[model samples]
Target: MSLAALLDLRGEPALVVGGGAVALRRARTLLGAGLRVTVVAPDLHPDFAALPVRAERRPYLPADLNGQRVVVAATDSEAVNDAVTAGARAAGALVNHAGDATRGTLRFPAAVERGGVQVAVSTGRELPMLAQALRERIAALLPEPGTVDAWAARREEAVRLPGAAREGALDALRADIRSAFGLSAGGAV
Candidate 1:
């Protein structure tokens, strides 16, 4: 079975071994996760001009994996992507192999964040269409931002209360959970 988890990988060093559309997508996701990314390729996609990643106008070298904790093998060349996967694995870094997702240790999920609520869906083997469909379905089910804010405030306050008091506070919050998003008092969001 696959395990789902939320990780805090901020400020970690990462590498992307491509510069095409696939590389662009992977780079954006890595950047969002707070990873300091460096993309190496002899040529780059036109869209890459807008991203804040470190760009290297050169071919990928195994030496590039140095100090990287995360790697994405997103080049159009399968051989290059495979090499990236091997190098990253040997370096003990989590790798996302775009050419063959199952061969890599990590597969990025399609995600949606709203009102501080994050929903992610992953379909391994690079089934992006499936993952995206599920992500959209889940996003449509999210509550309004106000409901999340109310819950967040309740959580913050409850942290200072005793166990019994905290339970009571949480119970009250649940009873009035409609506080927003598409949620309703007598119906569902």
Candidate 2:
């Protein structure tokens, strides 16, 4: 089973191999995660020109995987995606073949971000639609968007606790969050 964890992609480099809608979506997602994105494609959709990425208007080369923290194969061509997966494996980079999740090292889940919190739901590549539905359901439990400011304001006091005390503090925060969002102590709405 794939372990769930948050990766800090800020300022890290990643590659996306494609020029079409799938690649554009992946590129935007990566950018939103704060990764330095580079998109490789021979002919890009006009929308791609507006994105903040190093646009390599050419066929994806194996060398493009070198030093990348992550790589995504969003191309429609299965052969090209296979080549990208191999290159990424050799380079020790995590890869996601968006067209065929089972062929890649990782899968991207449907996610919802609210202020300082993020929830990601996955179905192990077996059911993306279910994951998306679950994400929407969880999103309904969140407080209003601006409440992150209240959590941020409490950050300094929260982090001052010792490591051993953090768990207890987190429990308290969880209770506070529950109260803020009208959730019961058992976490039901």
Q: Using lDDT, give the best candidate's number.
A: 2
Q: Write the per-residue lDDT of candidate 2 for residues 49-156, one digit (tens) a residue.
A: 899999999998888998999999999899999999988988888899988988888788999998667999998867989999999999988767778777666655
Give the Cα lDDT of each candidate. Answer: 0.87, 0.87
Give TM per candidate.
0.87, 0.84
Q: Alpha-carbon error at 4 in model 1, in Å? A: 1.5
TM-score of 2: 0.84
- What total of clashing residue pairs does each candidate reach? 2, 0
Candidate 2 residue pairs in backbone clash: none
Instruction: Count steric clashes of candidate 1.
Output: 2
Choose the strongest candidate by TM-score.
1
